[model samples]
Target: ICNTVYRRIPLRGVCTKCGGNLTLTVHERSIKKYLEISKMLTEKYDLPGYARQRIKLVEKSIESLFTNDKVKVTKLSDFL
Candidate 1:
């Protein structure tokens, strides 16, 4: 699963999972949105246990998508 996700990332460019082109800013926003949703789902709300578990997977995927860089220009895939 990690291999598939890693391969899906462009080496030095931006593209959606479907190979659709995306601006760097757009991709960053998309990832941030997912991260927020996952965080909310994990909170002690009215959500089911299973739902929170699934959202954790989404969070993990987002983690793999990028590195710990403050500036988002250097993609993690570039080091792959």
Candidate 2:
């Protein structure tokens, strides 16, 4: 499941189950925008709950980027 989610999140031009090709450029841009929004929120607000969720999401996005590049993470915990 981790591997599947890893692949789905980051890699561009991967094949879909229905034989279609998936691309990451658009998705990456979208995630980046969300990250920026999250960052801005963090800067402007003191809401711990909202900040925590955004932080987790940004971390996941970073993890996906690293995984997409075939970085050899020794353990899932390390990735986390």
Candidate 3:
């Protein structure tokens, strides 16, 4: 799914007119879809140190990519 959407995107960048946002969203979703399961499996099995580190690196990269750092709070009262 990610490959198909990625292929459709032009070399320059994502084009919003051609569902670029949707394409990127789908690609990210597909990439993260199996992340949890992979983590679980790694924990369940006695994988090598290198393998565990690789998964942790991937998780951190994905989180950094998808995380919004500049969120604005609209209403402090809402939280309380």
Candidate 4:
């Protein structure tokens, strides 16, 4: 049984008759975007020749909330 209520999806559901490719949809695009931006920001904002691994660890938190399209994030606060 799948519960979309809590956005709970089983990774792979077994088929009754014959087991087949049961793919689980994950939010991979978000992951990619976060990884890309963190790299860009850490380089630009932080000190030169700094610890990249540490930067990545710090970036994980910021990535969680940065979901909107980049332009859209800037536009909403402009409403007056």
Q: Give the clashing pairs for model 1.
A: none
Per-model TM values vs. the true structure: 0.41, 0.38, 0.54, 0.35
> For candidate 4, lDDT tens digit of each residue in 1-80?
33233245344555333454344555657667767786887778875655687766656655654555555544666985
User: By lDDT, highest first, what's the ranking?
Assistant: 3, 1, 2, 4
Question: Over 4 Å off in model 1, which ranges?
Answer: 1-26, 41-44, 68-80
- Per-model lDDT: 0.64, 0.61, 0.74, 0.58
Q: List candidate 2 stretches off by more than 4 Å.
A: 1-25, 65-67, 71-80
Compare the candidates by lDDT and give the number of the best one.
3
Error of 4 at 78 (Å): 56
lDDT (Cα, 0-100) at 57 in candidate 3:
98
Indicate the TM-score of model 1. Answer: 0.41
Q: Please provide the root mean square deviation of candidate 2 (C-alpha atoms, Å).
A: 10.8
Steric clash pairs (candidate 2): none
lDDT by residue for model 3 (1-75), tens:
233445465665655455343345546788887898888888899788888999999999998887778976678
Ranking by TM-score: 3, 1, 2, 4
Candidate 3 regions exceeding 4 Å error are: 1-23, 27-29, 72-80
